[model samples]
Target: MDVIIARHCVAAGEDGLSPLQRDLIEHPARIRIAEAPTGAGKSYAFQRALRDRGHRILFIVPTRRLAQNLANGLSNDLQDAGWSRQKAAQSVAIWSSDQTAVLRSQGVASINGVRLLQMTDLGSFDGGMIVATPEVVSGLLIRRRVEAGQAGEGVFDMLEQFDHIVFDEFHSIEARGFGLAALFARLATVQLDNRVGFGVSRISFLSATPLDLKPTLVDIGIPEEAIALLRERIVPDGRPLHGDVRLSLVDSPSLYDLVLDHLNEVVEELAAGRQVVIVYNRLVDLEKDLPALSRKLPEAGIDPARVLVINSVRDSTAKGRHQGGFAIGRQRDPLAYDLILATASVEMGVTFRNADFMLMEPGFEAMSFLQRYGRAARRGANGRVIVRIEEQRKPWLRAVVDWVRERPGERSTIAALTQVLSRSVQAEFSPHNTASTFGQLSSQAKWCTALYWSVLLEHASNRQPRRGHLLAHQPKGAGAFYRLEQRVRQLADEPGLTEQVNHWLKLFHAQAFDLRTIEPKIRVVSDTGEAYDYPRVWLQRETEVFERGIETGDEIHIQGGLDDYWREDKDRHAKRDWICHFPHTTRTLRLPCDERLVNRWCDELEDIDPYEFDWEDHPQALEAVQKLVRLTGLVPGHDPEISLDAVSGVL
Candidate 1:
């Protein structure tokens, strides 16, 4: 059945390039958004179109696994384009922080002169197909320009070389990355302003769902016309390439219980020679559930050996091997495993052609729902998708589940969810606010901070000079240095930004100076003149308040430098260091009651027996009782301490 369905899917009629692909090949927009279905051959079409245009491609994705998949997919395309295996492998370059670190640790200069490209090594990213994470590419686009640095110039040079920069799986990017893509495009505008060249850098956002296109592009300074260029090319609906697939939404208190409730059915399906995949979004949950599920499967008459756990957090080399092995195992032997437990790391790009069932613990985010469910029924295989969610817990999630339940097609489901999300976001949006970004700090400053930290961490690890001036080494060639000099001159005209950057340089140099030493500590004081010390965290916004000394009215203090002082008495001239004396803890008095007015009051007493108490003359208790009597204005029926239940029984 699987082989027959696979053949039918391969032989399905819509085999040529999509309309969007033909449009891109004929008249590519400066910035284009392509919306297409998963199995519509978008990747192949985009690669071929860009190649025909004589443009080097730089494919950026959200995760490492997707990068690996694209690298392999593009390599096959290169081979099909009449390139040798060795040459094809050399043409595709992967730039990631992890891969670069591995290469550096082995004492190798570069993988064909492509250093990690994280730091100032943008030259290696000169030509050919470069696949990188959003972090790396975004960092390069907005790198700081300095008088003695050529990194900024290197960035422009690399930008000029690539005609098309595609962000695949655009919907999966977080706010930071999505914003960075916008910033990257905006910076390209500045790059174009100074270029004497004849080439223009184009951007393509390829996704199955480009939900918030207008708002995203507008936030990044892209004009409305550029956004109107979004071309949607999808497979026509109601085509029968595979058998009828079933998708059910299961609501349960928890994913664990959902699995147990269907344990017999799962066992029966596995026993019938069907492959099952249990998808988890959390690693901790997967680790806990995998063993429990494995242990319980035996009682249901399923072999434990047929169950396997695939984790993404293992060592990178081991992780790649395991992912590759899983893909191969699935393709070569469809029923090799009865149950496969995986995380959302495999939700995109990777194919599981033979899996007959998918049980997903849907993530909290609505955007990822489509990608997770799309894993099932690949290559037209008949399959079932059961999304187990705690419906009562998350209202927004329940709304999305209901939406998906109503729409069977992937595109329609995404569209409805997108509209729902847009309304939710728009209702909360304030038009009075001029700034698009909804925070105190500017977006530029945030990008600067991200770049600053990446450089700071890298410099500290490489043991490079911490001094900002000394950090800028000489460029390799004259052309890059010349461009760097010109860029520096242009930046020197803004005095306000120049002054702020000078302050930032001093701060960076000081931090670099402390890189080799134990970080300094700050002393804090409580209201009772108690002193406590803790190591200073560079970016800590809130002071740590800890309980010290005995439990007898514990004192809390604001921990900081000697400048933080407080005056206990306004009349006194001397001020006490608040870090040592002014504790932030609140103080309250405790009074113990010696007698209970009724038997029902005995349960509220602690560490003392209410029956044997005799404190008629207690001053604090007398005051409390007097206050209660005045407030209520109720006279005692018989004796003030007598139980009302006993009186009622007598009546």
Candidate 2:
């Protein structure tokens, strides 16, 4: 059965602009948001709006690959629209810390013909477009704020240089602390309040799976009328943008088994010289399946050189061993490979030409599903997507499976599927909780921002010599910039203000900065003294359970000389290594929620009363607790007030 995933029909309004584009160009609000499905020309709309303004622009994306792609694309668009090649190349620049060393050595680097600029260059840059990730922006803001006096640049001074700042893939802001979304909220608040600032730049957020940011904005004191939201509406005469995509859902207990079952088809596609993309949810599953496929491919007369693998490891040295195929360290053209096996690394922003996709069910998020599906049948090419739905006991997964089973042969738009899943799966489990989660996350972000502002205020007052230790404290936050400014003044005269701030910084960093709770990765040393790091969670399973008894810094050996450890890193080191080696077969041990691990992880902050910390206000921190509980069972001897149930209720 074939299902047509339609794109929204966008008609041109005044000046040959779609309604969404027109609003983006003419809307009076200082802050604007555009919500449209993939391939609805959202990028083109923003490009036209920004081009007309001719303002110094800072375009922020979620990934380095995306920043590179957009920088090159923007340059081409400019040249095609009557600008000279030199002018177009000069107008667009990519700002990435990874390219810093290269830029310093060569003065400049080029990505697909667009210039890559050094971070310091931004201080002197007068105009044109600069593309960067959110982390770079946050780092710059923090560095400038901390070193204002000596650096001769304040946070406001840095921001005022840009006439417009656009955050692409704005949905990523829902991440815990100091994430892009929270930073946007804080900046929006500051701009709208007309605080002591100069050359205020308009901010825009673009996302296909847009969040309802209104509630979060209102909570931070922005008025409803001040924010403008432009959504792409379905038109009766609209046509599909990327032709039609045929979606087939297969019920399977294991995605690995499902892939093995379809090995013949995969080989047939490769033999016919058609591109194939298989997406796994974890590296462990990919590692297991690669060797099996590699062994069978030669028997089927397929060359091992046809398989390319990509994962989280971005080091060139780590990926150099895959001479038979290739790994994506520096960007390689996707068309060069006949078969590509990837994790979530390529799930967003990366485009592939005319490929058939096989994807493991990527949890309950509609955004993940939509993004992965968008990779295939791009432009006007028709495509097919085969999704392996593992049997799960969760209510949402059951509902999704039943829904797909019932909809056989019924054609539906991508937008319709998204809406249904958002309501059925996401809403059922945590509809209202999503906004609440972000609000709580934003508050923690606000506190971090407030701390940074307080430091700047202290230095500006000229009351005392600046403490170097205080400067070392990096503040991060999401909302309430005005309130944060107010707090800065209120704390100025207080004795021991620096000490109190430092104390809170330690606590916040412990709770918010720990990445293990979010992604639970482990490091392992191979039999040949090679080390590789990968996520501990099993990809074939549906839950968040992790393998137990594999403590960090444990040395183990692989049976057959690390034949295909694609993530092998010789020079790359970690403070601790987690597992002895990959188990011979899959293990079902749940990550024990032992109090010992929590204490060991956050030993320094154990003295502080968890009860006094207001866990209810910081949903991001609460989420960490929930994750800990989910991974390890309920912690033994844990403080009852801070138990999983308590934290879950707050969330």
What are the Cα lDDT values of the candidates?
0.46, 0.52
Any idea how many clashes model 2 has? 7
* TM-score for each candidate, following the candidate numbering: 0.56, 0.68
* Model 2 agreement with the true structure over 1-651: per-residue lDDT tens digits: 235565335566656566776676567676787776666666666567546666577788877667766777777788788888877776677767555545566764332122212322432433477888765565454322233233433344435666667877776663233333433444444432445223466677887766656555555445566678777675644433465677777776666677677778877777666777888876656665666766665676667666667766422222344523345453554556777777776665665545755545564455666667767766556667778776554554455556666777676776666665555444543357432111123333344333334333344322232233223222233223334323433332345444543333223222322211334444444444445544443211321112222243433334333343333323232122111100011111122233354334333232234543433444443344333322222122212213333322211
Off by over 4 Å in 2: 1-8, 12-17, 49-53, 76-86, 104-127, 144-154, 178-198, 236-239, 260-274, 297-307, 314-324, 335-338, 425-651
lDDT of 1 by residue, 1-651 (tens): 011112122222364555666655444456676665445455665567544444467778776656766777777777787877876666677776666676788887533234323222322332357778776664443332222233233333445666667788765654323444554454344323455222455777776544445454554344555543544432334332333356567777657777788777787677777777778876546644554665676778776656655544321232212211222221122234567777766666555536667788876554455566656665556666777766353554666555655554543332334445334333344443222112111232233323233333333222333223213321112133234223423332444335533332232222211111223334444454434333323112222232221212222354342223322222232111111000011111122222222221222221133343322323343333233222212112222222334332321
TM-score of 2: 0.68
Candidate 1 clashes between residue pairs 3 or more apart in a chain or in different chains: 524-579, 525-579, 525-580, 526-580, 526-581, 527-581, 527-583, 556-583
Runs of candidate 1 with Cα error greater than 4 angstroms are 1-15, 24-27, 50-55, 77-83, 110-128, 138-153, 174-180, 187-198, 231-244, 260-275, 296-312, 315-317, 320-339, 401-651
How does model 2 fare in lDDT? 0.52
